[model samples]
Target: MAVQDSPPVPPNVATTGGKLTGSLGVGSIVFMVVAAAAPLTVISGTVPLGIAAGNGAAFPATYVVCTAILLLFAVGFTSMARHVPGAGAFYTYVERGLGRPVGLGTAFLALLSYTAVQGAVFGYIGAAVNDFVVSHGGPSVPWWVWSVGALAVVGVLGYRHIELSGKVLGILLVCEVGIVIVVDVAVMVQGGDAGMSTAMLSPGEFLSGAPGIAMIFALAGYIGFEATAIFRDEARDPARTIPRATYLSLVLIGGFYTISSWSVVSAWGDEGAITAATDNPEGMVVDTAARYVGAFTGDLVQVLLITSLFAALLSFHNVLSRYIFSLGNTAVLPKQCGRSHPKHSSPHVASVVQVATAGLLIGVSALAGLDPVTEVFAWFAGVSTVGIVALMLMTSVAVLVFFRRSRVDDRLWNTVIAPAAGLVGLAVMLYMTAANLPLLVGGSSTLAAVITVVLVATFLVGVALAVVRPPATVVEVTTQEEKK
Candidate 1:
């Protein structure tokens, strides 16, 4: 017996809207970058410790360095993007630069990591929405509903114009940045709390909690910048626009995070900065703003924080869905995933599938008797961080290899040394995330070990499916007989 070709819609797969045009300008790309980072500013993995370890005035410096590192990687990464346009940013980069097997594995890894991020953000936003509703005398609905609601909206938008998504992201992002800026200015103008300390500038504190820790936090601010190449097709000009957006997004987000992180420290006064953050890391930024601007402003900031998260959900959903579409384009995934909407020119079908999957995941988590806040951070968010770090390293290698042949341009520095160095940094971060999983989950290392295993298992399943190969489409187009 031979395997039969199937025509049924495959599970966990969908058709994609084909390649997007390079019309996205520097501004839209900038929005995606901020949209990715806005949520991190408020809902940090370990906000309390940030003030103590490299989160003070020096935080900006740390971000500056990380941004430079990513920009360096982009120097080579973008050069390669000009040569290849696909939805799988990392996978496309690696496969074209490395080999098909590596690309296949990269795609699998990317789906796990980025999709987990999408689910993770849903959990966070769900909790926030639930809390807000209950506090306002509304019925205390479960977090699952919020997650499902967000998934639906993302699906609707994902089926439309990339420009529209960018516009929506831009509006929310501008608001987020505005709020952070308001708080930062208030803190500075009010002269901060009691005794001010320039000690934040000292590198001594940067290494207090293992030199790797500071570097690890710094890396968080750079994660989404790698997607610039992924947006090449949608970019206005792949040759120019994508690279400009790549470097520009990195600097803005990096500089913003560093400035805001330090602002929180200054607002508390160095003496209580760490203690206050430890006491209420998530709420500390709110409190810091309240201390200077009063309760009204603080509460307002919290509300905006909720909105900021929604923006993040929208952003990651786009990235995750695009990867799905890219998979289809490469034939590792269903042909449907490679399609583009005739009107919207986006991956409409892939977006719908992604939304449905995200909804199912949040529902499952809610039923599992888990704490949405902490558990989601540990199980999904932490895993995504580890995955992103690993992919960054791979992308760096891809860049180095892809450009290895072109000696005419100074590929040595842009393509080789700089990205190679970045790979080293990201590898260190991956190791730290694994070793300190407990820290990421707000649990003991023992528990973290178990959680790490779960994440790895999830990734393995994705890889297994890819290796097995999904049933691909066999589309047949019929045309009128040629008029002889």
Candidate 2:
């Protein structure tokens, strides 16, 4: 059933008391979402791995395929935003369509996915900072030390006005995108190693050599794009801004990934790219920069990579804090987490909790002597990819059901056709991701199994909590209402 024009609520409960407020326009929201994608990190880190371990030179095509699926998903997703506007995003949409328990479960899964990704970035950035410092003749500080320092910086930004975070992300995103584009142009202009070729775009090549693994990495790059709706409460003219930002974020992210990855393949010569990536996945992108542009450009890219990671951290901090804030406001979490800062109108309490939680994860990982990049980053990021893809699949189905039952906005394409197409596409992605989890998490089947169990358990725990203590704010829509 459609959301009630006015749902009844208890007098003591205050829905608007701790409400978050801001005036973020489409540009600001796009920056926040795209920055979280961390273009430099994806190109310099994830792309090489995808080429080596996945479909080789054809890995670039995966982005094109994923973009198509998600654009279809966005059709229904943005349409829902016009009706069910809230900070909860997927949680709100799923609840309005499905039911309270499933919606709560989706929220828990979203939290797990976003938090895991932020933790993964923390691990990666820590290692990157430590390496950069030692390379420049500085004392070799531990990676965790750098991670904690970065956490403190992000914590401060997340506690302030959202526009401040947006502005910072915008600056960092431009620099990172600029450097990659420069390298791409330089490689293209020089005719690449064996001249530019389009053979990599062929369907046969895309299906070559563990394509499922390639699909996982490609989808991971677009993780933050779907979070556009999480900022609904802060958006200026959300009905317009949210949809515009959603489509724009996908186009920019997808286009950059597709072209930049093709340029990287060209830099190595299409035939030899796989071997190069396999030999030196970490340094392939940087070395390419030095070769095509100049040594100084390589150094500049390394610095920008650090900033890109920091941007991702800050953007995710904002997204995760709002999810917590939404839960708090709905009474699923402690009400203190619902409170916005009186001055900044930010979700300061939830922001603080998110920082503490991330810090705790970093500490535990360090104490356990886990390799930050291999174990901490790989494992957490792998889990996040699986969780997010699953959430999207569920959301696609939710959109179809909501529109059909409620008879809200009966446009055939937006409500029925597009959501159905997206659902099928996402279902395939979820299966591929699940099947190849071992590769994504560093080739450990046992660890992959454990991650699967944890994800399932987390979603179930949310379902159980909802069953035991139904959230007061979650009104149950009846069959009679659907008939209305």
Candidate 3:
């Protein structure tokens, strides 16, 4: 069987036309990727929900498990990154390994997932902003107002050079991580409520409650880490930078979630943690901070929570814009969408489109009288989780098939064993995500079924589009010179 690869770039094309450019090093890329994971938001919002509704004290262990699985996925992912090129990370890889139609379908799905998550964050940040202002005796403002305001700011940043967004994200990431680390240290010094028990790490504890639910929530926190490759066009020395950033992101996100969640558990005592989480899921993290650190830290956490969501919004905006630019450059969409701003060397057209789409989603949700946090945030976020995990599963299979057929990088672990293992893990995660869609989307089985149908239809539409109007050939840059 013949193997497929993306078409190479023509020698005559100029750098400022269709290509994106930046001076992003490993640290900058890592900041963008990790910031998208939104550490503070996950620690405060998702952690309590995982504990109360998931496996109670053992929730932290779920992050450990998720991190290990994603690291396995990264082995083949980064290996392919060195050889396969383009901003269409998952889409490009799938096209290279599979054929164009399936790859195009994956592309559409990727767009949907990233767009959904970005909208979800918009809803969340709006609510965060509204709450902070009203609680401080400011005028009562609607959440959508704040969301739209954020959309404008993100749009402006995304339409500029990539380094600007990277720098901004780096600052926000440091502040959020710093606050969480402060609380973690305080918990350690004070010896926790139950004297720092490690029972959460026990296998038996992992299975105590709704472990499936716990797994899904934990997995959600790691959403944006895989986006490291999407910045390949902007990174300096991408072959080395992409892989290093990928590994560093996974390690940092995993370690932070695991240790911080454990501290939350310890602050309340194993038994008390579950009760507190159940009673006040929203206030669980904030109150824990107040108790362990100080009331001042708790207030600061609240403020930083909004910034954390803003960082995530900016990161996903950049990711989605690049995806659009890639598809456009390949003739999957209008050629103009692929064009970069000559002055900024950024994907200006695609960035504008992304911002417009998000704004439209927010507008429609508001017009329909939907609750920004519950309906918009929870529902869309659930859809994104399901969509992205499905993509990862597909990408893992593509990696295995690509390596086996092409005889490229024939090392057993990178080419075969790791992708296979990651495939199984991701497949399980997809199953859990799909099965618990009702719980994820606020317990409407009918709504969950609707989400599933919509996703399947979106993918089929992409496949049909590819068949009817095939994408133009795209450039594929390889790490090594061809063997004679």
Of the candidates shown, which would achieve the greatest lDDT relative to the real structure? 3
Off by over 4 Å in 3: 1-16, 473-484
**TM-score of every model?**
0.87, 0.95, 0.96
Whichever of 1 and 2 has more lDDT, that candidate is 2
Residue-wise lDDT of candidate 3 within 272-380, one digit each (tens)? 9999999998898899999988888767989999999999999999999999988877778887888899999999999999989998999998898888888889999
Task: Please rank every candidate by TM-score, starting with the best.
Answer: 3, 2, 1
Better of 1 and 2 by TM-score: 2
Model 2 weakest 10-residue run by lDDT: 4-13
Expressed as tens digits, the lDDT of each residue in 96-200 for candidate 2 is 788888888999999999999999999999999999999999998879999999999999999998999999999999999999999999999998999885756
Q: Give the TM-score of candidate 3.
A: 0.96
What's the true lDDT of residue 451 in model 2? 96
Q: Point out the worst 10-residue segment of candidate 3 by lDDT.
A: 475-484
Total backbone clashes of model 2? 0
Q: What is the lDDT of residue 403 in candidate 2?
A: 92
**Clashes per prediction?**
16, 0, 0
Error of 2 at 331 (Å): 0.3
